[model samples]
Every structure is written in C-alpha cells, then in structure tokens.
Target: MSGGVDSAVAAARAVDAGHEVVGVHLALSRMPGTLRTGSRGCCTIEDSTDAQRAANIIGIPYYVWDFSERFKLDVVDDFIAEYSAGRTPNPCMRCNEKIKFAALLEKAIDLGFDAVCTGHYATIVTDDQGNRELHRASAWAKDQSYVLGVLTAEQLAHSMFPLGETPSKALVRAEAAERGFSVASKPDSHDICFIPDGDTKGWLGERVGIADGAIIDREGNTVGAHEGAHAYTVGQRRGLNLGVPAPDGRPRFVLEVRPKTNEVVVGPKEALAIAEIAGSRYTWAGLPQQHPEESFDCEVQIRAHADPVPAVARIQPTENGDEFVVTPEIALNGVAPGQTAVIYVGTRVLGQFTIDRTVSAVPVGV
Candidate 1:
C-alpha cells in the first residue's frame, strides 16, 4: 500500500464493492531516518506501520511481505549494471515487472486472494473480441500507462487499478480525508523509489567503482578527464567541464557515451539528435497475434513524461526473437539506451520495448 492516500482509497472502494480485500505492504529492508515521505518510500518501516493503520481504519487485515533480496537482485543490481554500460535504466518499470506483477501478484493468488490491486492511474478494457487492452485514464495528466506497459495478459486478468477512473488527484485526497487516512496531503516522491536521494551517480560509483576515463571532443582529442564514463549519458547538456572553449563559441552537449573505451564524447547541439531506436527485451500486454513488425504504425514513448509520438516501427530479426526499430516522424533529442520504449495506438497500447541500441539515420542536408 506504500502508506499513500491513493492506495488506501483503492482498498476502501474495493471493500465497498463487496470484493474480499486484504492489504499487503511489501517490506523492503532499510533503516529509519533513511527513507523519505510519500508513496515510493515503501522500503522504510514507518510506511509499513502507516499501511497497517490504513488497513485497520478500513476494518481489514494486513501483513508485511518481505521481498528485499529479490528487489536488490532484480531492481538495484540491474540499475547499476545498465548505467555502467552507458545506459539509463528505469528501475520502477523493472520493479513492477519483477516484483509487483510477477512476484506479488502470484503471492496474492497463492494466499487465496482473487486479485491484487494498486493505485495506478490506468485502465484495462476488453473489446468486443474479449482481448484485454490497456487504455489511458480519464486523468490524462496523472496517467501512468508508460510505466505499466510491461504487464502481461495473465497479470491484468488478476489485477485492478482503482484510481483509473478517478479523474482528479484532488478527488482522491478528498476521499482520503472523508475516510480519515493520514497521508492524504503528503507530497509525491519524484525520485526513483529505491534511490530517494536521487544520487544515481554516487550509487553507481559505490557499487561498480570508477573506470578511469577521458572527455573527448568529436574529433577524438582528449579535452578533459571525467570522474567516470558511466557518470554521464548521451545528450547530457550539463556537467561537462571541458577545458577548451568551442571554436564557434556555442555550448556543447554530450553526443555519446562509449563505455568500451571509457570515453565521454561532447559536441555541438546539432549532434545530439537520433532517428532510429532498436529495443530489445519486449513484453507486450495486449499485442495481437500478428508480428510487431506487422503492427507498423503506432506511437512510441521513449521514457516516462515523454509525449507519445507517431512512428513507423518494425521488428528486426534477432537471435532470441526480434528487436524493435522505430523511426519517429521527427528526430528525437537525447534518446538514451536501457530505457523502455512503449508503443501505443492512441488510447490502446501496442506493447513495450527495452532499447538495446539507437542510431541517427537521417541523411544530412535533407
């Protein structure tokens, strides 16, 4: 429940609907004074107690489920590894796929609960053909379909999002007030859930250590020595302290990160554009029987908070299955690897893709 207003209200609505509901708070190991306020701080013990209080207030039983070991392996380790490879990984999406849907959902069913519910702002709908499709919530600004694009049909079959139709965040808080839940006015946590301090670079430095690296210009001249190559990412505009000034007196941006040679390449603003993205590790929730390549025209979101834009995509042949290559209608800026690429057809979602590689294929002077 994360001790948040949204989940508390979700529980109340479920119970009022006459569905048998029990609150399960996931206990991720972390000491007190370390975790911050908000729904994402589920690792802290205080949030666990708050969850229990919410359950008691709702007159339902609650329990803490320890999944710390799995979280470190599935979410934290992979987060460090991906950054080390010069890619930015979305830990929340990984946590949902590995911990929430696969782990927690199965655990709920095993414990005899018919379904697991959350406060996610998205909806699941069955069309005339009875195929499940993920759609955006009425509260478009608060919609979280991008993070949840990884869910499979089986998981959605036994999952519920109670705030899907609650068009306003204010309404949710009001409901919480009426119910007497405590965290109605808590500020939302914007950082990654596990790393509340927002220190991804420090976390990576501690885990993988630093790789001696140099900041090089596009022409391959060593201009500066970066603390580590993994500390930077493609299209980064700040933090490059190059000793030399640009020849044209224009601000330079991070054009690429070469993990193989431990190099941070910086160049002019024009160089930070990309055209093609090939994403691996695809998990589609409501995809049709036809190949992803056949599902050609769609909208793709390269990251959360990114607007879904029109694109022409194809499933490129890979050894395991296929990597998706999407050509956006316009060149995207700062496209990074290790981020999820979710495709959508308006409100109906196509699926999700883990970006393996991206390239700028637009011909110069076009």
Candidate 2:
C-alpha cells in the first residue's frame, strides 16, 4: 500500500467491492530508514508499519515482501549505470517495469491471486475481444500512466487500479478520512525512494566517484571545470561554475555530458531543442502495430508530468537491431539518452522505448 493515503483508500475500495484483497507492501530497501524525511522518500520501515495499520482497519491480510536485492540489481544499479553512460534515466519507470509489475505480479499469480491492484492513477480497459489496454486516469493532473508505460499486454491483463476513475486526489484523501485511515493526510513521497535526502548529485557522487573534468562550449572551447560529469544533466543551468562567460552575456545551459572523455558541454538554451529520438529497447503495452514499417501518428511523453507532444513514430532497421523512432512536430526540450519516451494514441498508451539517441533541432555552428 506504500503507507500513503491513495493506497490505503484504494485497499478500502477494493474490499468494499466484495473482493478478497490483501495489502502487500514491498520492502525495497535492505537498510530502510526508521522514519521518512517528510515526503522525500518511501518504502521505509515507517511506511510498512503504516501500511499494516491500514490493512488492520480494512480487515485484510498484510505482508511485507522483501524485494531489496532485486530492486538494487534492477533499478538502483541501472540508475548508476545510466548516469555513468551520460544518460538521464527515470528510476520510477524502471521500478514499475521490473520490480512492481514483473516481480510482484509474477509472485502474486503463483499465489493464486487474480491481479495485483494498486493505487496508481491509471486505467486498464478491456475490449470486446478481451484485449486489455492501458490508459490515463480520469484526473489528468494526477495521471501516472507515463511511469507504467512499460507494462506489456500480459501485465495489463492482471493489473488493477482502484483510483483510476477518481476525479481528483482531494477526493481520494476525503474517502480515506471517511474510512478512518491514519494515512489520509499523509504526505505523498517524491524523488527517488532510496535517496531520502533528495540530493541526487551527492548520492551518485559516493557510488560513481568524482573526477575533475572540463566543461566546454559547443565550439569545443573550455569554459569551466566540473567535479564529475555524472553530476550534471542536460538543460541544467544553475551550477555551471564557468570561468568564461558567453560573449553575448547570455547564460549557458548544459547541452551534453560526455562520459567517455569526461567533458560537460554547455551552450545557449536554444541548442537544447531535440527534433528526433530513437532506441532499440521497446515494448508494446497491448497490441503491436499492424504495419511495423509504416510511420504512425501519435503523442509522445518523456516525463511523468510533461505534456504529450504530437509526433510520428515508426520502426527502423539498424545494424545493431530494430529501433523505435519518434519525430516530434515541435521540438522536445533537453531530451537525453536513456530517458524513456512513451507513445500514446488518444488516451491509450501504445508503447515506450529507452531513448538511445537524440538529434538536435539546431545544429552546431548554426
């Protein structure tokens, strides 16, 4: 239940619907904190206790499953590796894909459970032919389908979201209060769960280690120096610490992180516009496209809260493998490799791909 208002209310609603529901809280950390630092992190010992209390109130079974080892290998390690490769990754996306749906759902089915229900703000729709599709929740402001974009057809078939049809998070909170859930007013967790302090740079610095590197402009001129290339991300402007400023007196933003050469590239904000992105790692949510080679119209979303953009997507053959490519009508800002791009047709999630390459809208020396 995540020890949050949303999950507590979701469990209550599931019980009210006359289904046998059991609340399972995943212990994702081997060494979890005794208490949460406000709402900065989750999956701690405090969260597990709150979940058990809520389960008691709801009159259901509660269990804390230890998934720490798997979480570290799949999500945490992947995050460090992506950063080391100079790509920004969405850890929530990986957690949803590998740990929650795949690992948890697999164990659930083996234990005779029909589906793994959660409080995620997303919907699952079944057609007449029994094909299940993933869609956005009714409340766009709290929609979380972007993070769940990695679910395949099989996973969607055995998934349930109790709060999908709810109009607002305020309503969920009210329902939880009415049900006497202690977590009704609990703050929602934000940022990476494992990194409780919300200092991603400092957290990564310890694991990835720091190396002095040169920060250069687009023209290959050194402008500043950075402690580590892994500490910076595309489009970051505040911590450049550049010794040299732009000749035009304009601020420069991080345009790229070259891990191999240990160089951070800075440039004008306009150069951050990305026109194209593609990757070989991809999976369809429900049904595969009938014509894989043909370009199809769709909307692409890179971040959880980012607005969808009009785009054209198609599969292209590459020497390494087949790549899912998207070209947005309007350029995407600060897109980076290792970030996932979820494609949507109307409200339905078509599929998603790990972006491995990006083509800038503005070329160098332009």
Which candidate's TM-score is highest? 2
CA lDDT of each candidate? 0.81, 0.92
For candidate 1, the per-residue lDDT at 149 reads 91
Give candidate 2 regions above 4 Å deviation: 34-36
Error of 2 at 229 (Å): 0.2
- The best candidate in terms of lDDT: 2
Give all TM-scores, in the order shown. Answer: 0.94, 0.98
* lDDT measured at residue 243 in model 1 versus the true structure, 0 to 100: 89
Put down candidate 2 lDDT per residue, 221-302, tens digits, no spaces: 9999999999999999998879998999999999999999999999999999999999999999999877968999999999
Question: What shift in Å separates residue 184 of candidate 1 from its native position after superposition?
Answer: 1.3
RMSD for each of the candidates = 2.1, 1.2
- Residue by residue across 76-165, what tens digits does model 1's lDDT show? 888888987888899889988999888898888897878889988999888888778888888889989888999988887887888999
